[model samples]
Target: MNITSTLVTCVDNWLQNLYTKMYSHHTETYENTVEVHVQETSSPLTKTLVLRILINEEHKQVHIPNIFIPLNFHRQGIGFGLIKEILKVANVYRYELFIVDMTPSFYDRLLNRNAQPAGYDAVRIDTTTRL
Candidate 1:
């Protein structure tokens, strides 16, 4: 059987406040093409969530445009795992800049929030994770 077959189920209101805070409360419109991938696991055959990334080699940066975990899979480390995977790849490629393009509140919660220590153009947006 396909490992992704076992994944199932995929939000709220203070929940409303929290949601807005986490995702900009749907205030902005986004238009672009993003490469989306699923973070899957074997044995139990589970697909935790989806991640979107856009790499700009000319700018020497990796953009994590979106990271979404279904409601049923939230708080299960799926999101964190996805970020970690991207960061790993970014480091390997030696990308100098990492842009998150995500909510400011959510970016503060990431492990690499402080990865960029210096340089004026080194960081921007809550959408960044230093690799």
Candidate 2:
């Protein structure tokens, strides 16, 4: 299978476990879901997950709850590419984007960088929010 499908399979398994753990104590059923987006290399031989982001869409808001990039992929432009893609979609749909649980240092680094991608300035960090 391609890297995207592989990543989705892996994430689905992880999410199942997470759901069980999170709702084990609750007697009521809850729908815990998020859209998973993966960024990976095009090469089949060296296919790697550059980044994975979870988006929770609600009403007119889009919440990015998690973004994971392997240590080896750090410093690459993959994160910016993913964010740009999300921004395009959000703009098209007129949705507000909120990044949740991002570290201040990371946010600072992204903003402080001189060569930020287009729409980088539009990103809003919601450190106190959870989705």
* lDDT top scorer: 2
Q: Cα lDDT of model 1 overall?
A: 0.42
TM-score for each predicted model, relative to the true structure: 0.48, 0.46
Tens digit of lDDT per residue, candidate 1, span 6-92? 111011111232333232222111232233333233323443324445556566555655667656557765555555554555555
Among residues 3 or more apart in sequence or in different chains, the pairs in candidate 2 whose N, CA or C atoms overlap within 3 Å are none
Question: Over the stretch 10-40, how does candidate 2's per-residue lDDT look in tens digits?
Answer: 4444434323423121111123233443323
In candidate 2, position 33 carries an lDDT of 32
In order, the Cα lDDT scores of the candidates are: 0.42, 0.43
Q: Tell me, by TM-score, which candidate is best.
A: 1
